[model samples]
Target: MNELLLTGDERDRAGARLLALLDSYERGLPKAEILPEPDRDVLASLLAAPMPERGVGVDALFDRWEDTILPNSTAVAHPRFLAYVLGPPNGIAPYAEAVAAALNQNCNFWQLSPAASVVERSVLEWLASVVGFPAQAKGILTGGGSLATLQALATALNDRVPDFHANGLQRASAPLVVYTSVEAHRSVDKAAAILGIGLDNVRHIATDSVHRMDVGALRAAIEEDRADGLRPWCVVATCGTVSTGSVDPLDDIADLCAAEDLWLHVDGAYGALFLLSEEMRGLMGGCARADSITLDPHKLLYASLEAGCLLVRDGAKLRDAHAFDSSYLTVAEDPLMTDYMDYGPQLSRNFKAFKVWSALQAFGVSAFREANVRTLGLARRLGEGIEATPGLTLLAPVTLTAVCFAVDGASDDDHTALLERLAAENVALLGPVVVAGRRGIRACVTNHRTSEADIDLVLEWLQSRLTGRR
Candidate 1:
């Protein structure tokens, strides 16, 4: 073969086929019933089989994806999909992802991906600006919210402990403790565990009646830990508790951190991006005060899977935590740009910023703001509907998109059955939520595709189910 991997004609043909496949999926969204109970046999056939002796061509792969793979995936783009806190990707993601793959920009360093580095910086700056942080704030896009939180915790660990990377957690004189509400995401605990911070070191602080973290109790816990000679270093606050969409008292948490000289890390993965709307700015103003914050672009920016960012107010601290020089990988960096390899654990990163920036540009910031506001409105409507229903008891405050409600005389098994029934009938897919040790059906309106009509249909489904049971 000559010095070529693929001929120009072959490349063009592949591109054309990809474009066609994408077009077909986009067109299928409209009258597609929003969901279809997946044929488990067909799905198992696709995944259960091992690799073939001969590779499947692009055409066969595309055919397999269309025929078998897609139906099993949750149709988050469907207007009726109001289950988990998942956002459908914006229209530009498919084309942008294709371009990113073709270009194969190594975003770990400026020398390897200059334009990509700048574009990522631009996207991060825009995100920081929305949170009312200054230009000095710095961040990097990671795989998703969990990775971002993991990176943030690692950075905090580095900042508080001297020579952490060298000695590791084993040599530390005192074990550091992290405070978080019981309502916090499991990602916090997962990150702590991954970083060698024992589970016992994590303090599951109690929350108030409304589910926000109890700041006074947190202070007491920290004081107790300190008195016991254990180091209390960081407090992880959550913006959206997964079960109830309850936002922690950020202002109070920030004040407590300031008084205690502790790192304040806000896990804003499910809720921070709402700051795009002016209406949410007042409630989330204290986000600017956080030492570091984690956000999920896949959830809020509507970017395709695996776009999360960890933003830090002090850029130098992030660098201090992650940057290290090695003979094999050393390279010069420009003052204006970031060598992102110095910012996170991964060195070979994809050009994730292109898809995020492309989506934002194609849809505009106003569209996202309106979409967020619409979701908030839909959640409030859902809460009111649940309250008005004869047998339904609104379990928690509808602070955000998550609506949890208990049906009279329904056991946890009843809720599980009801959820399956809803999904099987294509009424609407809702999961279960546990509130005060009792299980209830949870419908979260996180998708921008979800409309008021969809909400009413789900309510109708509930009514029909209740009548059938009676």
Candidate 2:
């Protein structure tokens, strides 16, 4: 037998060693540096090295991981790192991720992964219920919001065009047009361009003063497209814009799509999960009106990377866009078992749903809701703190968890320096946002790990920096 196949004694020793390393990680978790600068030369050498021709034993591999991989990666889990729309993984996430990997469930079809199939369907059904989608709603878990939006547009194309799959973009008789606000995520334009909808046809409709999509501009754009002999096919609305966290007027946009006989897709990837909190239901009530929606559980639900979802009101349409007969992988769709391959593009898929579902099951929905509510409240508090400070000016309305602000009398350079200084000092890791033509430091308090104390600390750091500049 090959030495690679470990005997009973070897297996036991390896297991014990692994346990010790994991225990150290668990014990040192709290004291670990929030952000550690990496030795890039060492990292580069490891990355550039040829895949070793010979096997490195587990003991050696773990040592390399502790010294290299763990330190080089960004520590998004640090409560003080308030940048971007990312969330720290829930406590159960790592364990669930390991379990899913061990099981190695191919979540494509029911027979291949019976429990995974049921788990995925169950998760989708629950998400649909939260969005108030009816019994006919269906969805597939995706890598992230961008992929979900892209897939949604693909489904819309299949539904609207008579021969999209058969003769894609070959005929130019009536070109399709897509409409979205200027503040919408770039994913909308990307999808249109990929679908051969033509960049010129994508109308970046004007936004209102607060950055909500202008309903009137949308109407005029559709009319202008019709007059110009262009096909107005769909509308992509944002629940929370990437820059200022503005929610495009979803109800009005949905009405326009209906009037124009076009598909309505809501990019709710960042904001939709906020629906879990009772405080956010009214603000995001319009999501239910969308024919299709994209949501990111990884961002808000605190699942590890790569857990996003796309829900369609008419779930059958998702299958319509993607389903194709494959003789080798045939399995009749059983009511009890969902053949997820029919729902989206992939036939071989990892069991992503289990990680998300496991988190929800372990924490319960109410805990997530409370944590989201707290994050929202903290953002508002930080915004208020910025407004109260004499030198700091609010850059945008704190509509959600993103707080954008600029230090008074500070040039763009000053603002950038301040941000970098805070990050380097381990005070906080915030990002930048651009509104109209002006740029400012932005903090997205989306992590459940963050608290009011962390926000106050960041605020104090900003105050001291502002004082020093004077």
Question: lDDT tens digits, residues 39-147, model 1?
Answer: 8999778679999887676567777877887777667787777779987888888889988998999988788898999999999999999877777889999998899
List model 2 lDDT by residue over 383-431, tens digit each. 9999988899998899889899988777888888887788777788898
426 in model 1: Cα distance from truth in Å?
Answer: 0.6
Every candidate's lDDT: 0.88, 0.88
- Compared with the true structure, the alpha-carbon lDDT of candidate 2 equals 0.88
Least well predicted 10-residue stretch by lDDT in candidate 1: 1-10
> Model 1 — TM-score against the truth?
0.95
lDDT of 1: 0.88
